[model samples]
Target chain A: MIPALGLLLGVIIGLALQPTVPLWLQPYLPIAVIAALDAVFGGVRAVLDGIFNDKVFVVSFLSNVLVAALIVFLGDKLGVGSQLSTGVVVVLGVRIFSNVASIRRHLFNA
Target chain B: MTQIPQTPEDGRDLDVQPSTRTAWRRLLRAASPRPTKGTLLAGVLAVALGFAIAVQVRQTSNAGLEGLREGDLVRLLDTVNQDNSRLSDEIVRLEVQRDELATSTDLEQARAAAQQRLDALGILAGTTPASGPGIVMTIRDPQAKYTAAMLLDALQELRDAGAEAVQINDGRVGASTWFADGASGAVTMDGRTLSRPFVITAIGDNNTLAAAMEIPGGVSETARRMGGDTTVLIRDTVDITALRPLSTPRYALPENQASPSK
Candidate 1:
């Protein structure tokens, strides 16, 4: 439930921030911010549920950012940045779908 | 607790079986819900956001395409006009050289040099010198709205037709030249602004080059589709001259001048 709420809030924030951001930073900001916030919310929830490790959370967050940046940088160098980003979005989309499905099961199972 | 039978015929064991079963079922249902509403809502929101982003991206791409097209059209016209002025200047210079050669004491050498220059110019213009075969191709926009790509295609066709040299609106054709738009969508080429009705000239075996250009799906066809006029004529002699030496190239050659020696 908390993850869902966080995702919704992140979407709203992204939509609002896109137009106000600088052109150079605009491409990276909305999606990055949303993903980071979503991860943070999930981490907090896990900690509350007594399943979180600070080390694991920190490592996952750092690796996620590093991988995303590396992919973007390599794509740009290869002249296929847009295509690579699209692929990343597609994978993120599948993950989001599965996450949402699990959240739904948690909220409405009776 | 022992089960107390309320009715013998009904077999009701409310004190034990029924209560235990109800509690267990309730606990099981509480542990697992069939549909999680939170997940459904999040999924829908994400999809909607993705759709919105896709629309915005498409709109931006369309705008860029239009910008590029406008830029190309403006550049093409400008290139033609700039070339015309350059050709006029070259013609003037050649005339002056001819006059000087005619009056000089070293008349024979000067005349020879002048003739050679004239011959070079003639070849560059797609004109025959004295008595040879050359083709003349005149290109103009019929509706006065031709694009840079169309002009480029025509130039490519001329080259493929075995043209030794080509000129447009009197400007010598070179690799560095390209059409681009300037302020307010005006066409500019090589810093010179130009208008429409671009004239192109080519020097070659007039008949052969003309035949090549006339091939099906060739430049002539493309020009026709673009509503541009193309006239190919075989001239007995045509005068063409090289334009003034090109300014410094945009990119410099590598500095390793002695690499081959090693």
Candidate 2:
């Protein structure tokens, strides 16, 4: 309940503020958001598994966003930024799908 | 039929099954797991994630150029640059024309040129009187020896001497002027008979015209041989005030017309 409320509040604040992204950070924001989504899904599956760890969740969330951004930054320097961004999104998407499937089974058993 | 399998097993299975409400409660319990310290942190992280996603989505939609590659962006910049330069060139050309018109010099120049052309045409068409330094010649023919042809020759000689305007006795020498002998054996110019001592007034360079009349075998010598005498006097200003009426063409048409009238 708290997490859901927090997400709603964040969305409201973002809409109200309408912050403009800087040029240097533009390429990394979307990649970081996808990585954070993957982390959230993994955390939800772990909670359903009865093996949720606060420390592990926090560390994984931060590291996922950072590593994703780093890889894209490196790709930009190597002239392959778009390709690397695609690769990262594809991998994270797969993970989110599998984790959501696990959560579904835990709840529905079907 | 053959003593259907009516064991009490079906009834026992129905009695052991949990109720729908309890099954739903159990699923809810399993789904929540244990709300631990991570819940608060997860809530905070969720906030950050949601905010970032919303902002990124907004930015992408707003600009729509964020996803383009560097090469595509460069090409777009090039196209814009070309358009900017072309428009600027057009603006510069229009500005030069505007400046020229604003100064009013072009208008004045055009008016002056048109006035000059009108004056020249008026003189050429003999619709205007002219005056300048020129010579006047008088022929004294007591025996009536000078014929119309001799007078015509003398007039042609004056024309060759660069005479701009000429008059014989009260008749204006125009493009259509003709000379003929009247029934009384006197020279008639353009149907007007001239009295003895014909006065010819011409507007031109005084020196050139005087020299032309005095040339050997010229009008003066021929006049002396015919029992007549000719005398020339140069003057600073001789006005040829005779003007010809404007004559409209009867058959000719301007070239720009589509067809001529029958």
Candidate 3:
């Protein structure tokens, strides 16, 4: 319940601010969002397994966002930005899908 | 009882390699229903994730141009270039029209000025008829004693009084008019002989011309002393209809066009 309220507050703040992103940071925002989504799903799965840890959740969320953005930044310098972005999305996408599938299994007992 | 992995102190769950059967047993383990510090931390990360997603969505929609195909972008560029060239062509055409209008106005003004100059020159050269307020004098030389010099003096006095056009009998006075004594002791002007009463008409200010003739020791007095009576009548409109033929110069040439040897 608290996480749901926090997510709603965050959306409201983002909408109210409507901040213009800087040119240099524009390329990393989408990748960071995807990585954050993957971490959130992993946390949910850990919570369902009864092994949720505050330190692990916080560290994993921060590291995921940073590593995803760094990979894309490096790919841009190497002229392989789009290919690397696709790779990152695929990896994070598979993880998110498996975590959601496990969460569904835990909730539904199917 | 199947043991479920728990990482409470150091959070090291990596040491346990759980097989599929054990993972299923761990998934079956009941989660704590009470809110903990880990749940609060997850809530904070959830906020960050939601904010990033919202911002990324906005940025993608704002840069909608990025989603266009290459061919569509090329076509849009082609249309813009065509419009640019067409507008420049219209500007060039309008500029040419403006220049033509400017030159045509200048041409019209030049023509009007040249026509006005021609009219003034015609009147000055004695090749045009002129009418104005002046005096007509009839000199009766009943004694036939009035000489060409006396008549010439009368003409010169009218000129000094600002006469613009002058006519003596049937001849118009011009730049080249001359007076001389004829064979019959009468006055001959430019080879035209005059008889008894000489009528001179001059176009000028009526008051000033009449005063010039009637002044003491002037033309009227001089004529009376020469055994002739002069009659000066001031008229409002004295018309000089006689015109002089324009004679082409025989020996005199315009300085600019004269032969260098000459």
Candidate 4:
């Protein structure tokens, strides 16, 4: 409930401000969003399993965003930014899919 | 209870079970986190992540270029660049045309001034008609002393006296006119014969021109000494009605061009 409330507040503020991301950070934002998506799915699954930890959820969210961005940045320096981004997306995609599938089953009791 | 083996060491479970269960429950309570008012940090991080995602989505769609391929973006950039350069070139061309129009108005005024000066010169050279206050000198050369040299000298005197236009015996005297004496005191001016009693018309200041020829030992005196009659009259207006024919230069070119040495 707190996460949902927080998400709503952030969306409202962002819409009102319309702040531009800095140029150096622009390349990482898409990857970070995907990483955040993975973390949200994991958090939802944990909540369903009755083992949700606020500390763990917050730490995981931060590390997911940071590591995803860092990987892309390093790959860019190494001239393989697109390939690394693809790899990261593929892995996060599978995790999010599995988590969603579990959430679906848990909610539907199927 | 039935699955447990009844051994001598396992008999302690019965005695220690309640206390150990309470300790384990205390540890679980301490380790697991529930969302309380103190979970502000987690909420804030979640908020920040949500904000970033929303902003990224907005940025991607704001330009109306969502879902465009990379090649399409490059092509759009090229078309925009071409438009910019074409506009720049058009501005430069218009500026140059504006400058030319501005200077041409000034050039037109200068050309009018030059044309006026040229007309004045044509009058003075006797290639055009002129009317002004001047003196008319009538000469009766019964003694036939108004030779070609004397006629030429008279023209020079009138020129020195500021005569702007001149005619002698119905012939317009120009810069290149010549006099040739014929038989029995007859005169040929510009290949046209003139009978005796020549009338010379000159246009200038009436007082100065009359005084010029009337001066002692002037052209009038020279004429009198040659046994010829000379009469000077100041008039309100004199018309040197004859006009010289303007010739187009055939051999002479503009000075800027190289010419063969004579």
DockQ of each candidate, alpha-carbon based: 0.05, 0.25, 0.21, 0.17
Q: What does candidate 4's lDDT look like per residue over B1-262, in tens digits?
A: 1233222232423332223233334335533555675357767876887799789887887745443434566899899999999999999999876665457666776677778998897886767778888888888778887787777888888888898788886889887788898887677898898777878888887788878887787778888888887888888898888888887669877775666543
lDDT of 2 by residue, B66-125 (tens): 656677799999999999999999999998866765667688865676788887776666
Candidates 2 and 3 compared by TM-score, better number:
2
Top candidate on TM-score is 2
Question: TM-scores for chain B, in order?
Answer: 0.44, 0.55, 0.56, 0.55
Rank order (by DockQ, best first): 2, 3, 4, 1
In Å, candidate 3's interface RMSD is 5.3
Across all models, the iRMS values in order are: 12.2, 5.8, 5.3, 8.5
Tell me the tens digit of each residue's lDDT in model 2 across A1-110. Answer: 55667788888888888998778888899999999989988877665655567789889999999999999999988989999999999999988987876665545443
Q: Which of the two, 2 or 4, has more TM-score?
A: 2
Could you give the DockQ of candidate 3? 0.21
- Among residues 3 or more apart in sequence or in different chains, the pairs in candidate 3 whose N, CA or C atoms overlap within 3 Å are none
Clash-forming residue pairs, model 2: none
Error of 2 at B199 (Å): 57
Q: If both were scored by lDDT, which would come out higher, candidate 1 or candidate 2? A: 2
lDDT of 3 by residue, B1-262 (tens): 4444443332333454344454555544423233677667767777877776777778777876453334566898899999999999999999876666467667776577677887666666778888889888999888888899988889999999998888898788888899998776778988989866989999999889999998898899988998989888999998888888888889999887875642
Q: Which stretches of candidate 2 lie over 4 Å from their true place?
A: B1-35, B64-73, B94-262
What is the Å distance of residue A46 in model 2 from its true position? 2.1
Listed in order, each prediction's TM-score against the native is: 0.32, 0.46, 0.42, 0.40
Native-referenced DockQ of model 2: 0.25
